[model samples]
Target: MTQQSLSKFEEHLQDILQYRVEKELLIIKNYPRIIADYDRDLIIELMESLLNNVYCFAEKTITITITLQEKLLIIYVKDDGPGFSKKELLTATEPYYFQNKNSHFGLGLTIVEALTQKHVGNLKIVNSIDGGAIVSAVFAIKVENLH
Candidate 1:
C-alpha cells in the first residue's frame, strides 16, 4: 500500500452525490491530506453505498467526515433523515435484508460490509444524537507507510 491524497476520494464521492436531484446534499470533509495505505476501491464502494442510502432517505443534507487516528482511518457519512428502526439497525448490514421488502433489493450495505471486512475494517451504523443516521467505517492503517 502506498500513501495517496484523499482529494481523489472526495472527487469520487462528489460525482456520486451529484446524481441525487431531489435532496440538497452537502458533503463536509474535515480532513487533511490523509496519507496512508488505504484501499481506494473499497473506500469508493463504501462512499457509494452511503451516498445512495442517504439520497434515497435523506431530507435535507448529508455530511461526510474523513479523519485519521493513530493507526485508523475513519470515514463518517451522516444524513439528516429518519434513521433506522431498532430492527433495521440490527440487520441492516446483513445480505438481502431490507427494511421494506417491497422497496430495495438490499445489497448495498452487504457489499460495503463485505469490502470493509476484506480490508480488515469495521462498519458501524448508528443514529447521531443530533438526529440523523451515521455510518462510520474504521479502517486499520499502517502509519509507518505514510509519506
Candidate 2:
C-alpha cells in the first residue's frame, strides 16, 4: 500500500480503538450506579451510546439487564421517554437515516446492530413490559469476545 493508504488505515483503526476505550470507560465508571453485582458491559455500552447522545437520558427512565445461558448471551437496554414508533425503530439505526432540520433525527441503532452482528449477534427494538423502548441483543459466548 502507498504511504497515504497506510496513514488512512491507521487513522481508521485508531478511531475505532479510541471509541471502544471510551465506551469501556463508561461501563466501568457507571457500574455501581446502575447495577449492584452484575457485569453487563455490552448492555452498558448500548445504554451509554444512547444516553451519551441524549442529554436528558438519565432524567428519563431507563433500565438494562442481561440474560445468559451456557451458549447464549442477551443484553437489553430500555428507555421510558418517548419510545420510537414502528417506522422510526425500523430505520433508526441507518446512519443519519432521517436527518435534516425538518426531519426526525436518531442515533444509529442500525449501525449498532451491525456491530452486534460482528459478535455473532442481533439487535431488536421492542416495547418494554412497563412502557418504553427496549433494545435487545442476542450474542454468542467466546473467551476472546470479552474486550
Candidate 3:
C-alpha cells in the first residue's frame, strides 16, 4: 500500500472512533429516562456481559456505563465489529441461534433476552459495520420491576 493510501486509512479509522464515541454518549444520556420504571442490578449485569463479550471480538472497541437521570437506569454497550444484519439483531432472542458457528451452545444472546425481558425492555443488537455491536437495555426505576 502507498503512503497516501495508508494515511487515508488511518484518517478513516479516526473518524470511525469519533463517531462511536458520539453515539455512545447519546445512548448513555438517555439512560435515566429509559430506566424510570425498572431495576438497576439487572441492567448492570447485562451491560457488563455485553461489554466483556464484545471486547472479546478483536474488531470491537466497547464501552459500558450507567448514567441515571430522573427515574431511569440506562445501560448501553457499543462496539466498533461488523455489526449485525437486521436478521441477526432480531433473532438474537431466539433459542440456539448462533451467529458464528461455535459460540458455546448459543446461549449468550438467549441470556441477554431473558435478562432484558426481566427488565421489561428490549435487548437489541445493532450492527456497527465500521465494525461493532451496540447493545442497550432501558429499564424503569423500581427494583421490584426486575426478577
Candidate 4:
C-alpha cells in the first residue's frame, strides 16, 4: 500500500482505456482530486478487471464514479450493457463462474472481491434500474496524524 494522488490513478485509467480504443467505447470518469492510501497496483488491477468485463459486454458507454462518504471511498463502475442475470448477481464473485463462452477463465470478479477484502473493503454487484450493470467497491480511507 502507498499514498497516491487521484491524478496518478486517472492516468493509469487512461492507459487502460487506450487498450480498448479499437472498440470505440465512451468512458466517463467522475471522481475528486484527493490523495488516498491504498495498494496502487491492486487498485489498478481491480479497475482493469472491472473495465475489461464491462467493455466486453457494454453497448456503448461505461461510467466510473468515485465518491468519499464519511471515511469510505466508494468506487462505482457501470456499463450500458445487458445487465446481469439473477444467478450472476449472486454468484458473480465466485471463482470460475463464467457467464459467457470466452477463452479466459471467470476470475475477474473473484479477483476484485479478493483485492477489496485485502483492503478490508466490500464489493457489490447489481443492475441499474434504468438499464445496465453496476459494480461498486468500497474501501475505508485511512487518515494519518489525526491527533
| Pairs of residues at least 3 apart in sequence or in different chains that clash in candidate 2 | 93-109, 93-110
TM-score of model 1 (CA atoms):
0.86
TM-score of each: 0.86, 0.55, 0.59, 0.85
Q: Which pairs in model 4 have colliding backbones? A: none
User: How far does residue 96 in candidate 1 sit from its true spot (Å)?
Assistant: 1.0
lDDT tens digits by residue: candidate 3, 34-77: 21233334644565455445655535245554554444445566
| 141 Cα displacement, candidate 1 (Å) | 2.3
Better-scoring candidate (lDDT), 2 or 3: 3
Which residue pairs in candidate 1 collide? Answer: none
Better of 2 and 4 by lDDT: 4
Q: Output the number of the lDDT-best candidate.
A: 4
Q: Report the number of clashing residue pairs per model.
A: 0, 2, 19, 0
Tens-digit lDDT track for model 4 on 1-147?
677775677788789888776555454555556677777787788888888777877887788887767567688988888899999999989998888786467888998999898888999999999999999999886633221
TM-score of 2: 0.55
Better of 1 and 4 by lDDT: 4
For TM-score, candidate 1 versus 3, the one ahead is 1
